[model samples]
Target: MTYSGVVKVGGPADVHELTDLMISKVAVGPMHNNAYLLRCRATDEQLLIDAASEPRTLLNLIGESGVASVVTTHQHADHWGALAEIVDATGARTYAGRLDAEGIPVPTDVLVDDGDTITVGRVELTARHLVGHTPGSIALVYDDPHGHPHVFTGDCLFPGGVGNTHDDPEAFARLIDDVETKLFAQLPDETWVYPGHGNDTSLGAERPQLPEWRRRGW
Candidate 1:
């Protein structure tokens, strides 16, 4: 089937195959958190993003080819509900943003900052540290050589607007600024965005709404 990037809890994952990489996206847990299992076609090595919840389902999705690394996008409880469990089961190296590493219960093996590289075999994903959403929320960028860029935005971004700042103007401003400068300004409109929860969207689909989102103060 074609990769639509639409996944639901208790449903099958949506797989997107690139030239040298395979991305499988699934929704797990009560919050319907999205977890991505990335496998390198060349070396067969795998990396998982956001072990949110439902360890059993995640383990089942992993199958025999265990993951080599697990990256928690942020320190939010909903994002790492299955981090320690998945880590213990697969013995995968843990990675988190340096500023939010302390908040995650599982000891982060690698504390990442902006511009850090995480490899899945031959594929390299660049980390973009987006502050405001939990201080250390990060978005992973995979610039496909053959195609367009793909970004995994935890809770920092979604289709309509940036993540909730709980009416805090400063936090919202910081998030929008980082998202605009680091993501929107740097990447092209074709960039695919995989969020922490719910369905996916593209930069082009959201670009026109920047002014509206800012004005609404959400």
Candidate 2:
């Protein structure tokens, strides 16, 4: 039985595989925020990223997978709309960057900092705090043993450019610097970026436009 590639629009989880991991994206709510389900193939242990909206849909997608934790990419309301409900239903521990933990409506079980390691099943994800999109915005990096690395960048990065920085010069500079140095400088070009909203892109695809995004000041 082969797995289909269709990402069910406005409904169930859209499943995809990356080496030993399984990733599912479920688009929810008026904002169409993406809620990702990450599973480790060897142990079947799962972790969800951003329980954005529509608790029922999110819960349905998590069926029988045995979720270990839910990590919110940032404190933005759109990112954790269903967080409380999902946590209550699954009893899974919650994690978020320490700087933004207080802004969230629910209590954070683990306040992660930059360089901290989060063990999911047999693999590990490293936390990189990318400021300016929000004070505590984070990107989770999972390096596959056989293939290119994968990153969940939340709202700090996207296909065309860096995340929205609200037109503030300082904020823009901070975000651009962190993105350029911490992300693009360190990670390989083939690293897959799964953002908080919309479609996915690779660091290789967005690397060249770094100068343009900085110049445009968006």
Candidate 3:
């Protein structure tokens, strides 16, 4: 949770062009958790990811970004504690993966499964199921302005550190394998990985760790 940075989600620079889509991450709450705001530059539409453990802070971002949806990466409290705040702020539909969908603490507007596509203006989010951190954990992929793929990996993967898999030791092992086989292996080497709570890193940076992950697999 110590790492932090902001990639301009909507514009090339301060211009906030509203042309290419934007993806920004914010660290909030007592847990210093990571949440994301994704806005389509062309449409000025926005979505919030993992609204965990903070209302005021989350609402402030929602107000600032004009988000239209609140999506969950998992059901853990640190990942979804701010659901109520995000929903109230944007009147945005809320979504969660099937396993964790019912665990969102409130009713969800959409139940997302693997291979689902969520459209927000010009941006389309493809949900990929990577179950290891939890029974239901998913990540998102979308095309960036550079034509490179980007992922909003919430608690699923971090810069170099992984999430709290020890809580469910066996599941954590599978999570690591899933990352190497399903995530790191498939995404472009240069694909940008926006972790749930740390500085961004490219897939190339994470690729080398796959063998170690395989060894550590449960």
Candidate 4:
């Protein structure tokens, strides 16, 4: 089946295949958090993003290959609901943003920073730290060699706008600025966005609304 990037809490995951990677996206937990299982085609090594919830389902998705690493996009509870359990089960190395590492209950094996490279087999994902939603919200960028770029934006970005800032103007400003400079400006229009919750979108689809989002201050 074609990859739609649409998933529900209890539905089956949507898998996207690329030349060197296979991205399986599933929605889990009450919050409808999206967890991504990335498998490297070359080495068969795997990595998971967000381990958000439902350890059993995640483990099943992981299968016998297991995962080499689990990256928490941010320190939010809903985002890492199953982090400890998943980590315990797979013995996967835990990675979190340097600033939000302390907020996560599990000890982080790797503290990622902006521009840091994380590898799964032969595939490399670049971390882009976007501050605002959380002091250390990181977005993982995978630039596909054969196609467009793919971004896993925890809660910092979404389809319509950036993540909520609890009405804090300063926080919203920082988030919008970081998203524009670090993401929109840097990436191409075809960049596919995989958010923490809800459906996926592209930078091109959202580029036109940047000014409106800033003006609305969300």
lDDT of each: 0.95, 0.88, 0.73, 0.95
Better of 2 and 3 by TM-score: 2
RMSD of candidates 1 onward, in order: 0.6, 1.9, 4.6, 0.6
Residues 1-218 of candidate 1 have per-residue lDDT tens digits of: 78999888999999999998999999997999999999999999999999999999999989898999999999999989998889999999999999999999999999999999999999999999998888999999999999999999999999899998889999999999999999999999999999999999999999999999999998
* Candidate 1 residue pairs in backbone clash: none
Q: Which stretches of candidate 2 lie over 4 Å from their true place?
A: 1-12
Runs of candidate 4 exceeding 4 Å displacement: none
Q: Write the per-residue lDDT of candidate 4 for residues 1-218, one digit (tens) a residue.
A: 88999898889999999999999999998899999999999999999999888999899999998999999999999988898999998899999999999999999999999999999999999999999999999999999989999999999999999998999999999999999999999999999999999999999999999999988889
Range of the 10 consecutive residues with the lowest summed lDDT in candidate 2: 1-10
What is the Cα root-mean-square deviation between model 2 and the actual structure? 1.9
**What is the Å distance of residue 72 in model 2 from its true position?**
0.5
Per-residue CA lDDT of candidate 3, range 1-218, in tens? 22235433221111122247755566764666767777777778888888876677667666665678888898887888878866776688888888887767868888888889988777888988888777788898875656778788888888764666766767777788677777777788888787776567878887787677556653
Question: TM-score per candidate, in order?
Answer: 0.99, 0.95, 0.85, 0.99
Clash pairs of candidate 4? Answer: none
Instruction: Report the Cα lDDT for residue 114, model 4.
Output: 98
